[model samples]
Target chain A: MREEADVVVIGGGVTGCGIAYNLAKKGLTDVIVLERQVPCVGASGRCGGGIRQQFTTDANITLAMESVRLFEQLSVELDTDIEYEQGGYLIIAYEDEVDQFKRNVRLQNSLGLESRFITPEEAREIVPLLNIDPIAGATFCQTDGHANPFRVVHGYARKAQKMGVEISKFTAVTGIVVEDGQIRAVKTDKGTIKTNTVVNAAGAYSRDIASMVGVSLPNKPYRHEILVTEPVEHVLDPMVISFKTGVYFSQQKHGPIIGGIGDPEEPSSYNISASLRFMKRMARTVVELVPAFGHLNVLRQWAGLYDVTPDAQPVLGWTEGVDQFCQANGYSGHGFMIAPKVTELIAELIVDGKPSMPIDDLNLKRFEGEITGEAYVVG
Target chain B: MTEIVCRCEDITEEDILDAIDQGYTTLEEIKRVLRCGMGPCQGRTCIPLITRIVARKTGKSLAEVSRPTTRPPLQPLPLSVFAGEEE
Candidate 1:
């Protein structure tokens, strides 16, 4: 299936649709998205769906604030119902880390985010059933929220197509054609697509996709597991997080309690099976956090891979000596939430001949161990 | 009754023991030969049952039974829903 297009985007996850949406909206209409399997078969649909602006880095914090604003108005902006609930974010602190929470809240407030340290009593006021004794302090942000991930990708893909972008699902890219140090075309299972400009948004598999062009991406897959409870009434209004335990949960509109925890030994893979240890550990944390969830049965649990870079920040710039090759891959775990601005940045980098933001600091070259500092508050 | 364990693939504890007795060592190999948990719903409903069966049959810990493969449509919808108009 040999074809020609103005741009060929690889990987149909959130970032892929994001880049396509922005490019189509920016007037580069001849775009084709080649997906390996169905869309959202990757990390996009499998994420925690928590959108927050709390970050240790200035760039991520600014991008997240901008992203939260977009998510707040995304339904009207995209002309589709995204079910974006502006529930607040609660980060619980225990042990000696209570001081850390206070310092983070102070820094966050100084950065213009509506975050502050509160007493354990205030924490329980937000979530009545939460265990407040062992908890020393908490950071509350009123702007952070959660959304349905499937709707986000579907929304962008729909809007991208409405703006004239072609997304071909089940199209696995096997090779990238480069000639004279420039990307010429992309070879996929369906056929070869002749295009000078190509964007790599392959999520966890970004390293493999970039390797086809002889570029070694530092991105690697890490397993993140999540679980859901049987439908319960709307009791929890805010998205709760425990910095001590890697647990976060939100009561969805459908009434099911959805959330996940970070695993220390989560190996890299596309594997999505839930583990017994994770269930037991997650159950323990869930019961400790919200005692009311103890009686509710776990309907299902699942796992997905996160594309983790060395610094955990996304690599979002063109490679040296590789012309016409733009990359927006390796968000580590924050890809889904920041995708809108990331896509717009990548599209502007392509069409406007430069990025609308100061994205030069995000190139792959910054992760050579020289820039070790990055955001720490990830759930 | 030992019970019919995996309803999605109609696998039972007796069938699992039979596969292990036939020298099927790994879970993947046993699943390949017996079709233990393969179906439209994938392994969501059948996995815990298979894990329990394998742990009971092999006299191993529950954690040693190994995790099953999870495919896409984490919730399976019709391909048609993804088809038709791009918008």
Candidate 2:
């Protein structure tokens, strides 16, 4: 790799590529992105690919709303097919979460989103295959959808490379050299790159990068597994999500039903091994939600790590001691959905010194105090 | 050339035994050496079958024979996604 110049972005997933693309657009050429493996080798490639604006918090909803707008024009802007489909996201709620679902819908409505609370029967109308017996209430947003994760990251990486951003795959960063509270260079297995700015976008390994700079980040990595069923005739239209079960499923454009479930008790580690426990739990929940899923054969299963913060919000902007180091990590499980907007803000922060959008609440300092509301709609 | 176990990669029971003869013991190692379960299905079809073969060959239980470490890009993707256009 070249000796490097302006900015060094770690992690070649969607977020890192998104940052590189935005930074290159800002005329910051000589950008280097380092990925330990191929792009989308982590959670970005393994996620459910569900882009939803139906969030309980304004921060998440706003981020998703802006990202959806970008995704609408991405295929043309990036000159590649992202396979984006706006089949919408249907969030069904049990009796316990009905109040929270109603409040979330009202909050989403106040922000000019067309999200609304619908009866269980209306949910069935949207997805006829759904078993609505257990669903007490539901929320629907037509703007939410899923895209091909591989295509999305590849588009960003390809578009950024065309703009003079160098993405080095299989380049593992061993350490970050910081001197007197300023970043000096990033040490990698390939070679050392002298840089004044470092964007620690290393998804699950963000904490490890932070510790190298003598800073501590509260983000932990948890294994989240997903499986796909054999492709069949189009049956499900929208991504069906349940907060209580932490399970979500959606039909891809190619026909496979892809989805995953979260185990809260799963310890923080980099173990990506898929478990039979998850398979059994997912089958039980999915079949209960849509009885037709019981007949479909499961084709494959895999796991990815979620870089989660305590409050489930991302820690953006500059850290305290590291002057030249900026962070755009800790997106929890929804990083793929909000990547475009978050990376745009990170680009603004790196080049123009401030983001056009306000993300003051999303910082590491917020974790020092008693952290209140979390992004409860995690799947 | 016996019954096909891994439909994704078209690997059969005889192929699996040959893989064992070649010293590919673990599920992950066998996948790398023989391509037994490394296909579009990512071993979902052949893991159980291969587990049985490895267990019976090595005289170990299925639980003792650990599965291979699942790497990223769990599914096969086109190389064009990475190969930059000729300028």
Candidate 3:
């Protein structure tokens, strides 16, 4: 490993690799990505890979829309098949969430998204397997879908490597050296590297990395669990989600049904151990939503951490006191969906000193006062 | 003649070696990239075979090559069984 570098990215997930690739594409090739384990070993590899624009926040919807566009052409640009499928996302609403669904669909439409409100009967028409007895209504966005997260990270990492970005696997960052409120170097388990800029793209460990430079971030890690069933003939097209039950499920391109549910009672911790509780709860919820799923055999189950914030939004831009220490984490649970656009904007911010898109509202300083939390975050 | 290590995913010994050559040395990393051990068997038969190949290729002992993580329901079971429904 070289003893010096221009910029050192702290994580090797899609966000870190994507940022590295975009930066190198913009002629900043002297970058090094440090991964604790292999690439996509974190939340990126563990997520359900559901990409949707049906969000309650403007920043999320805007970022998701652009990310979808980028994902459409990502396979061609990266010279790899990311398995991007725009099969659409269906968010079923219960009686209590019908009004919120209306408002969300209207806002999404006004923002140029093709999202619209559909009745429960229409939802069943789209997904005949859906048990719509408990559904009051739903919102559907045809442009939203799922992709292979592993292939995406692999594509970005491979392209970044081809563009002369060094990716160091099995390397863990120990500390960040800040001198007079400016980044000076990064100390890893392998050795220390002298650098002027650092991107804290560490997913669940972003808060830990920020604290190395004495910057306090309010991000906490919450354990989220997911499971997949044995592959069968393709049946489910759209990803089915419900805000009330906190359950989301979609059929993968390979034929298996993958999904998860959020436990409101889950505490903040790094514990990623899969639980019997989650499996039971997920089984009950999914079977009730779609009875056909009850006959499908569950193949495997796993868990990953969601680096959560108080407002359920990512902390982008630079930190208040730490100069050259860019914040690119705190994505809660939707990091994989918004990584393409978020990393592109972050790269623009680093190279051009300003992003083409407006991200002033997503800075780290917004947590001081009252903030409106995002309402559409699923498990 | 080509030798298939992971029959579930139809992956061969050459494919596993190629993935290892591309810097994916770990079992989990190779599994994610090649989908060798991710099939219905869940790495039951292929894990041992791939372990030996990885060990021989990377010059590590079989013990040194970490095993793939084993998850629940050792066999594939329907969701109705877990949901407490009469199937």
Highest-lDDT candidate: 3
lDDT of 1 at A310: 78
Candidate 2 CAPRI grade = incorrect
Better of 1 and 2 by lDDT: 2
lDDT of the structure predicted as candidate 2: 0.83
Sort all candidates by lDDT, best to worst. Answer: 3, 2, 1
lDDT of each: 0.78, 0.83, 0.92
Of 2 and 3, the candidate ahead on lDDT is 3
List, residue by residue over B1-87, the lDDT tens digit for candidate 1. 767766755777788788777545446545544545444446666668777767777799988877755643456432223221232
State the lDDT at B73 in candidate 2: 51
Model 1 residue B74 CA deviation in Å: 14
Better-scoring candidate (DockQ), 1 or 2 = 2
What DockQ does each prediction reach against the true complex? Answer: 0.02, 0.04, 0.74
lDDT of 2 at A334: 91
For candidate 3, the TM-score of chain A alone relative to the native chain A = 0.99
User: Which tens-of-lDDT digit does each residue in A1-379 have in candidate 2?
Assistant: 9786699999989999999999999999789999997677788877989999887777888999999999999899888888899999998888988887888888989998898888999999999988989889798999899988877887888789999999887799999888888888999999999999999999999999899878999999999998776667898888889888999999988687889888877898999887767777777778778776777767567899999888888989889988878888998899999988999999998899989998888978888889865556555
- True lDDT of residue A52, candidate 3: 91
Kindly give the stretch of ten consecutive residues in candidate 1 chain A with the minimal lDDT sum: A370-379
Instruction: Give me the candidate number with maximum DockQ.
Output: 3
